[model samples]
Target: MKILHASAEYFPYIKMGGLADMLASLTKEQSKTEEVYVALPLIGKLGKSPHWTGKEFPALLPQDDKIDSLVVSVLKASRFLEAEESGLKLYFFQSDLFQTLDSIYGHKEEHFRFAMFSYACYALSQILKVDVFHAHDWHTALSLALQKDSALPIPTVFTIHNLAYQGDHPFWMTGFLKEEPFRLITSPFDHDGKCNYMKAGILSANQITTVSPGYREETLSEPNGFGLSYCLRQRTLDYSGILNGIDTEEWNPKIDKRIFQTYSFLDWKEGKLKNKRELFQEMGRPSLPLDAPLVGLIGRLTYQKGFPTFLQTFTERRHLPHRYVVLGSGDPEMEDAFFQLSETLPEVFYFYKGYNESLAHKIEAASDFFLMPSLFEPCGLNQMYSHTYGSIPIVSRVGGLRDTVEESNLLKFKTGIVFEPNDTSSLGYALERAKDLFQSQEREIVVKNIMNLDWSWKKRKLEYDLVYTKAIELKI
Candidate 1:
C-alpha cells in the first residue's frame, strides 16, 4: 500500500514534542511493509535535506486563475527536497513561508502558513498517487478538509496528536469566494463562528485517531476535548486511538554509547551504579547517602507536566526526602520555582534549566524511579523510555499514564506506580512508595518487570496498517 504521512516536523531534523518521534518511528517501521512517504515543511535554518532530488510539482489546486496564480508563486518558489532514510522516501517542501518563519510554528500567520502548506502537500500527494493521505495534527487538517467534498478519489486519515493546538483563524479570510473552494474550506473549519482546523478534520476525515485509547476517550469529553467534543462525537464511528510507539533501537540501554554503562535486567544494579556515579560527577552531589533514591524527570517544565505538583511537593512547606533530577525549560514561573527548590534543598533536588538528549538517556539509566506526574498525558514517551531503561515510572492515573502503567501481573512484567488525585500530596504519597520500593530487596523484580515490557514501534505499525486499510474501505 502507498501511504503518505504529512506533518510540520520530523525527528532528528526538527522536533518540539513526541509527535515527531512517533511519526519518525512509525514511518520507519511501516516502510518494511508499505511504501511510506513523508512530507515535511522546511524551516530555512535547517536548510534543504542532505540528499535532494531537485524535483518540482505544480502545487496548484483545482480552482480558478487568481487563486491558481498565488498557488503557482508559492509552488514555483518551493522545491520538493527529497531524501531516503531507513527505506522511507522523505519529501520536504522548501518555501518562503517556512524559511522566513525560521521555526515550525509560533508565527502570527500560523493559519495562513499551514493552509498553504496543506495545499502543497495535497498537490504533491496527487502527483505521487498515494493511496492514503495521513495528516498529523491541525497543521495538515486543512488538507483533509479540502478533500472532504472534492472529487478526489483517495481517502484521508487525520491523526490528532494534541487537541489543544487547533489552528483557529478568522472566519472571513476567504469570504470573497462564496463557491466550491471557499465553502469547502470554511464549512468544516467553522467552530462557534471561527475557523477551527481540527473541527474541519473531524468533519472531513475518513478516519480520525489520537495517540492513546485513554486520550481518545478523554477528548470525547469536556476539559480534555478543548471544545471539540461535539465534533468528535459526531464522528464516533470514524474515530479511535492507537498508542504512540517509540524506536527501541535508538533508545535501548544495552548498545547505547551515551550511557555510562551497558546493561540489561540481569545486571541492572551494577549498570545503575555506574550511571549514577557518572551522573553525580556531572550534575554534582551533596552529602546524601549513597543509596538515596533519585527520581528523574525529563520534558517541558510546564503545568501539563505536573511541575505545579512538583514545586508544591518540593517546596519548603512539604519537602520530599528522595532526590530529584529535572531536565527541561518552560514557563518562567515554573522554572524559577524549580530553581528555588533546588537552591533551598541542594541535597534533595537538582534542576537542569534546558534539555539535553544525551543527559535524558543518562538520567533514565541512572535513576531508580522516573517521575511523570503529568496531570494529562497523551501516550507519554518518557515513561516508556524510563521503563525500558529499568527506571520504574511513578505517574498520575490519567490518559496514557493509567493505560500503560498497571499493577497487574506481578510475577511477570508489570507497569509502575500510579497516583490518584493529581496534586502535591498525592505526588508525595507516590514518591514515598517509590522510596520504600527502592530500599527493598525485591526491587529487582520491579526493575526486571519494567525491562520485559514491549515498548517497540512494531506492533503499533500493524494497527496503523489496519487503519489505512479501513480508510481505503471507507472511500470505496
Candidate 2:
C-alpha cells in the first residue's frame, strides 16, 4: 500500500513541538510495510539539503490547464541521520512564497503562506502514486478538503494534533469560492465570515482522528472543543483518538547524549541526584539544597499549559519548600512572571528563556517531578518523556494526561500525580503531593511502573494501520 503523510514541520530538519516528532516517528514506522512519502513545505534555503534529489516539476495546483500556476521545487529523498528511517521519501515543497515567510507561524501574511503550501500539496498529490492520504493539523487540512472537493477517489485521513489552532482567516479571503456550488466545499471553510481550515478537514476528510482517545472525546464536549465541537460531534462515526508515542531514541535516558549523565530506572535514584547537582551548578545556583524536591516545568509558557496558575501559586505559596526550574519561552506576561520570581527569590526559582534541547533533556533526567498542568492536551510527549526518565509527571486530569498517567487516588500501581481542576490551587495541590511522595518508598515503585510501560512507535503503528484499513474500507 502507498500512503502520503503531509505535515508542515518534520523532525531533524525543523521542529517547533510534538507534531514534528510525532509525524517523523510515525512515518518511519509506517514505511516498513507500506510505500510512505512525507510532504513538507521547504521554508529553508533551497541548497540546505544535498541529500534530496531535485524533482522540481511544473504543475498546476488544481490540475486546470487554463489557470495560471507557479512552478515549485519538489525535493525527494530520505530524512538525514535517522537510523530506523526505512524506504520513506521526503517531499519538500520549495517555493518563493513559503521561503520568504518570517517563520513557520505568526507572520502578517500567515493565511496566504499556508494557502499556497496547501495548494502545492494538492499539485503534488495528483502527481504522486498514493493509495491513501494522511494530513496532520490545520496546516495540511486544506489538502484533504481540496482533494475531496475535486471528487478524488483516494481515501483521506485527517489527524487533528491540536484542535486549538484552526488556521482561521477573514471569510472575504475565500472569495475564490464564490462560484462553487458544493456546500461541502465552501460551508466548512465558512465560520461567520471566517475561513476555518480545520473545520473544512473535519467536514471533508474520509476519517478524522485526534492525538489521544481522551482528547477525541473532549473535542466532542464543551470548552475543550475550541468552537468546532459541533462539527466534530456530527462526524462522530468517522472520528477516533489514538494516543501519540514519543521518539524513544530521542528521550531514552540510557543513550541520550544531551543529559548530564545516562542512567536507567534501576539506578534512577543515584542518577537523578547526580544530574540534579549538575543542573543546580549549571543554573548558577550552586548553594541550592539538593534535598529539596526540584519540580521541572518545560514547554511554551502560555495559558494553554496553565502558565498563569504556576506563577500565581508560586506567588501565593512562596513558603513551599520545593525548587522550581522552568525551561521555555512564550507569552510576554508569563516570561515576565518567571523572570520576576527568579529575581525575587533566586534560591527557590530558576528560569530560562528560549528552548534549549540539551537543558530539556537534563531537566527530565534530573527533576524529582515534571509539572505539566495543561488545560487541554491532545497528547503530551513531555509527560511520556518524563515517565521514561523516571521523572514522575504532575499533570492535570485532562485529555492524554488523564489517559496515560494513572494517579495514586484510584490505582494502586500508578505512574504519576494527577489533579482534577485547572486552577492554581489544584496545580499547587498536585505539586504538594509530588513533593510529599518523594519522601515515601512508594515514589520508587511509581517511577518503576512508569518506565515499564511501552510507548514505542511499533505499538502505535499497528493502531494507525487499523485506522488506515478502516479509511480504505469506507472509501470502498
Candidate 3:
C-alpha cells in the first residue's frame, strides 16, 4: 500500500510536542511494512539542505486572496534513516504566506495558515498518486474535508492526538463558502456553531483514532471530549485507539550515549546508582546513599501535568524522606514554586528550568522511580520510557497512564505505582508506597518487571497496519 502521512510537525525539523515524535517513530516503523510517504509544514527556520524540489501546485484557501493561489513545495525529510532506506518519500510545503514568525497556532490568520496546509496536503496526494492520505491532529484535519467535498479518489484516515486543542475559529472566517455549500461542507456534525477543524475531520474521514484505548473511551465521555463527546459517540463504530510507542533505539538506556554509564536489566542496579550519584552531584545536592529513593519528573510544568497537585502533596507532607528532581519549563508560577521548593528544601528537591534531551535520559536511567501525576494524559511516552530504563513510574490512574501501568506489575512484577488524579492525598499515599517498596528491597523486582515490558514501534506499527486495512475496507 502507498500511504501519504500528513502532519503539521515532523521530528528534527519542527517539534513542539509528542505528535512530532509519534510521526517520526510511526512512519519509520510503517516504512518496513508498506510504501510510506510523509508531508508536513515547513515552519520555523530550517537549514537550506532539505529544500523544495517539486513544482508548485495551485490551491484555493479560505479568507485571504494572497493565499488563494498558494504554491505547494515538496521538501524531503532526511532525519528518519529507515524511512529513506525503505523507499518511503517525505515532502514538506513551503510558502511565505503559510509560514508565520509567531507561534504554530494562535496567529491572527490561524485559519488560513492551516487551511493552506490542508489544501497543500490534497495537492501533494494528487502529485504523488497516493493510495491513502493519513492526517494527524486538527491542523491537517481540513484535508479530509477538502478530499470529501472534491470527491477525491483516495481514502483518508484522521488521528486525533488531543481533542482539547480543536481548531475552532469564528463561523464568519469561513465566508469563502456560499451559504448552502458552506452548510453542506461544514455540516452541523462537523461544526459546533463555530468552525471546528478536528470535528470536520472526524465527520469526513473513513476512520477516527486517538493514541490510547483509555483515551478513546475518554473522548466518548462528557468531561474528556471537550464538547465533542456527542459527535464522537455518534461515530463510535468508526473510532478506535492504538497506544503510542517510543523508538526503543532512541530511548533505551542500555546503549544511550547521554548517560554516564550504559546498562541493561541485568546490571541496572549498579549503573543506576552511578547515574543517581552523578545526577545528585550535577544538581549540587549531596550524594546520598545508593539505596536512597530518587524520584524524577520530566515534563511541562502545567496544570494538566498535575504540578499543582505535586506541590500540594510535597508541601503538606514534609516528613517524607524521598529526593525529587524536576526537568521542564512551563507555567511561570509552577516554575517559580519548584524553584522556591528547591531553595527551601535543598536536601530533598532539585529543579532544572529548561529542556535538555541528554539530561532527560540520565534522569530516566538514574532515578529509582519516575513521576507522572498528570490529571489527564494522552498516551504518555515518558512512562513507557521509564519502564524500559527500569525506572518504575508512579502515575495517576487516568488516560494512557491507566492503560500502560498495572497494579499487578507493581506488586508481583514490581514494575510501577499508580495514584488517583487531582488528589494530593492519593499522590502522597502512592509516594509512601513507593518509598516503602524501595526500603523493603523490592526495587530490584520492580526493575526486573519494567525491563521485561516492551514498547517498541514495530509492535505498534502492526496495529496501525490493521487500522489502515480496516480504514480502506470501510466505505465513506
Evaluation by TM-score, superior candidate among 2 and 3: 2
Which ranges in model 3 have alpha carbons more than 4 Å from their true place? 46-87, 98-106, 177-184, 187-192, 286-290, 409-411
The C-alpha stretches of model 1 lying farther than 4 A from their native spots are 47-49, 54-58, 61-72, 173-185, 286-289, 316-319, 408-413
* lDDT value, residue 382 of candidate 3: 90
Cα lDDT listed for each candidate = 0.80, 0.78, 0.77
Rank list by TM-score:
1, 2, 3
lDDT digits (tens) for residues 1-476 of candidate 1: 89998898788677778888889898888888889999888787653344665655555554532553454565556666777788888887778888766567677777767877877787778779999999999898878866765566569899998888888777776442234333453765577787888887778889999999999999999999999998898887888888987888888988888898989989999999889888988887735455878889888877788878766675632444577889999899988987987898777788899877789899999998898888788888988998899999988888888778875545354578788735777777777778778888768887897898897888888888788888999863
* Candidate 3 similarity to native, TM-score: 0.89
Q: Report the candidate with higher lDDT, 1 versus 2.
A: 1
Give the clashing residue pairs of candidate 3, or none: 414-446
Candidate 1 backbone collisions, by pair: none
Worst 10 residues of 2 by lDDT: 74-83
Give the per-residue lDDT of model 2 (tens digit) for 97-171.
566653576667666566656655665666775788898888888777777866565688999998989988887
Please report how far candidate 2 places residue 364 from its true position, in Å: 0.7
Cα misplacement distance, residue 70 of candidate 2 (Å): 8.1
